[model samples]
Target: MSRLRTHYPLRATILEGRFFQLSENEILHSISLEYTSELTRLHSAYSIPEPDHPRPEISSPSFRIYGTEYDEVNRTLVGVLALRWIHFNDYESFVGCQPNSVKLRPQSFNWICNIYRKTIKSNEDLFTLITSTVINDLGKAPSLTTDYAKLTGTDINKVNHDMILYQVIHHPAVAETLVPSLTKVSSEHKHDLSLGIKLGAEFNFGQLAQAENVPACLSGLKTDLKNNPRAFEMRFMEQLLDIAGAAGHTDYTCARKLVEPIFDSYKNVYDVAIDIISGNLGLREGYDIILIRRVELLQRVGWKRAESLNIRDKEKRALMRLLCIGGAASIKTADLYYQTFTAVNLSRTVYEGLVEGLNVDGSLEQPAVQPTYLPAMCGLAIANTANGTTGEKMKALTALLTYLSRVLVIDKDSLSFKRLPEGVIVVERDLRQTIQPILESAAFKHKPDILTDAPMPRDQVAKMADGYEWSFTAISI
Candidate 1:
């Protein structure tokens, strides 16, 4: 057994108000003291900010320390994963956390709690919250999978966890006790609740299992279907909880803020693209310099491996930088542009159907203007990772240029994307004219004498073009 499991009994006893028994064994007393110290240290490292209103007294029996069949060890693992390392074995659920224990509350957590307390007011609501938290992972157990597969006379490997959950929850023996607890939810909603849970699990696990095969944008589509019309908040809740749980293990970092809130007040992705074309000093000097330096830096590293760039933010300046690079690449290699569009968001099986030349087999014509290239933008970020190819990076830069000329969005929201009407496509001549001055200016900053080398001999034009084609205006800087 794991060390956690071995110590579960002692931990459970202490949590269940048997603290008086700790002095019986000298070793146990020492262990208790050590545990207490760890809790204190954790609280110091991960203290939560005080919320506006006092936190509710969460006295539900479901939140009790030792009621569920899930032992303290398993609960601790779950707690660490979804609860920001707030161990279930430490106290009587989240609301009853000890003063010294770390609480993992963020702004999002407070918003969720407020909604739950004000809107959801029934025994069934409580059950929905509890079961979604604890029992959601029941299908993940190997033993359970084996037993379930045997019962259904199916191959264990072929039995998906979601399918197993759907069956187990509705099983005659289990449903007899489990189904009635959802007293307030209608029959239709009860079904949605189960499906939402299944979809949420898939949303979490599928991303890990099929990272390369699945597009990042479409990773949550399955869950979103359940959440359409905002009918099933439980799905979103489960996803958040699962991420919180696993965050204890994952080394997540925030992206660099490329656009401040005031500056980020763009109409949409397309608006940002237009702003890039208009060319602010920051765009020319800041973003352009970063791209040029980044590409050169990557080229020097040669292609052993590439780590994924942290390019997931929706800030305008960041989006503009992406649009400038990836869009330009797509135009330079229209075939690659089309190939990337077809390959993006399509399932792994569908992508395999495309011919090697990447000719679109269907009757779908090349879009007259820019299509929503959000997925491709995201894919480019992934391609820039340590393992990414030189060709992929080059393609990304070229595509960004194309985006500067031909971006559009229907949505007004800056945080999310929505497709709009076809925008004017900036051709190669226009792009070169607009970008050349900026590149020269950038070169001048690093080497003041760059202009002196003006109107370079004809022999050097092809070399410069080659450099620009691959890395987009390779300034020496």
Candidate 2:
């Protein structure tokens, strides 16, 4: 177990937005059989349907509708669902009351309600409901004052406040920030991995523990990885410890340091790829084909809006053309100097490399994280350059992890808001002052080809011509 940071955390998806009471069918359709069974059991026991994702120990879960908000990211109608807890006694009234006024709660309540009394805090100590039967004397009377969460036998409100603070920190999005990634090997160096480090969402240990099911149908992880000293459990423990350390729940750095030898000793996927990659990565060795293949790979993952480019523009335009074709929105041209297409593309190959890298899907507002540039570049740059100096190595190490274990919390309301490497260009920026002239020259260079028998948007083209400049530097034909 790791050292306690502030308080024991019980995390669940905290939803916020207007919510219509989902029909029985709607609710049942969304959840799994096990979840449906649990809900049924809870309704029978307390009349309240158990929360789909319950916050542990806090019973009688319910929700309230306030108003509606637009989901700009999802580009669809969406509603927020806030999690509410009804006290033990409020269960009967809560269940009996109409949906309209059911949002209200009991007046005389335990101090545990203090967690909900205030706006959740972003950072602080922890306080949770701790019911103790023992009686305490508060000057005038000997009474029950221990039902609410307490700290040092004093300041119950602060204790309650701390509990709210705990909720904020424990929120998956917030929790992800607390943890940092480790200095792991590069994707290029470790070739056999299928997916890079998952750093986008909350850590669901139960989901990861299911890695036991990842091995082939006939083989268990124990039998498959017999060649390695550390078994599946050991590898999982390392992963768990890394997650815990990054979430700032514990200081697993020392523990990680202790196992440095074992980690370094493990043979990775990249070890087997040395012979194969050496010849394939030489000068002018079908690099153009590689770019096409990368674009194909991008298309495989949903980036389909690609414009073909001739080899004449191949040297300066491959990546930028890919970027241009992919709709580089909010992309700093300086960051993507089109001059160094080959070097940049090579880096992409090295980064996305032999193993596929994880990319959070792209959107109009924020861009998807650069697929492999940040993570792979960081490790290779450090390993190749910073050999003797400890300080340099540590700096490089931190940078490497930042790229791998980078987690960005996304609103789960819609698929559009998810972070994945989406190849489609949502927002296209016209950085090319050259495009208008190119279009103008192409439009008028030779007689309007009007290859299509049907009418073209000549009116729209005329309107565009009024606003922009035109040049005929070179004829299209």
Best by TM-score: 1
- The superposed Cα distance between candidate 2 and the true structure at residue 232, in angstroms, equals 19
lDDT of 2 by residue, 383-404 (tens): 4322335334333333232222
Task: Give the residue spans of candidate 2 off by over 4 A.
Answer: 1-66, 70-477
Give candidate 1's error at residue 339 in angstroms.
18
Whole-structure CA lDDT of model 2: 0.22
What shift in Å separates residue 84 of candidate 1 from its native position after superposition? 11
Candidate 1 residue 338 C-alpha distance from true site, Å: 17
Off by over 4 Å in 1: 1-109, 171-192, 201-231, 248-477
Local distance difference test values of all predictions, in order: 0.32, 0.22
In model 1, the worst 10-residue window by lDDT is 457-466
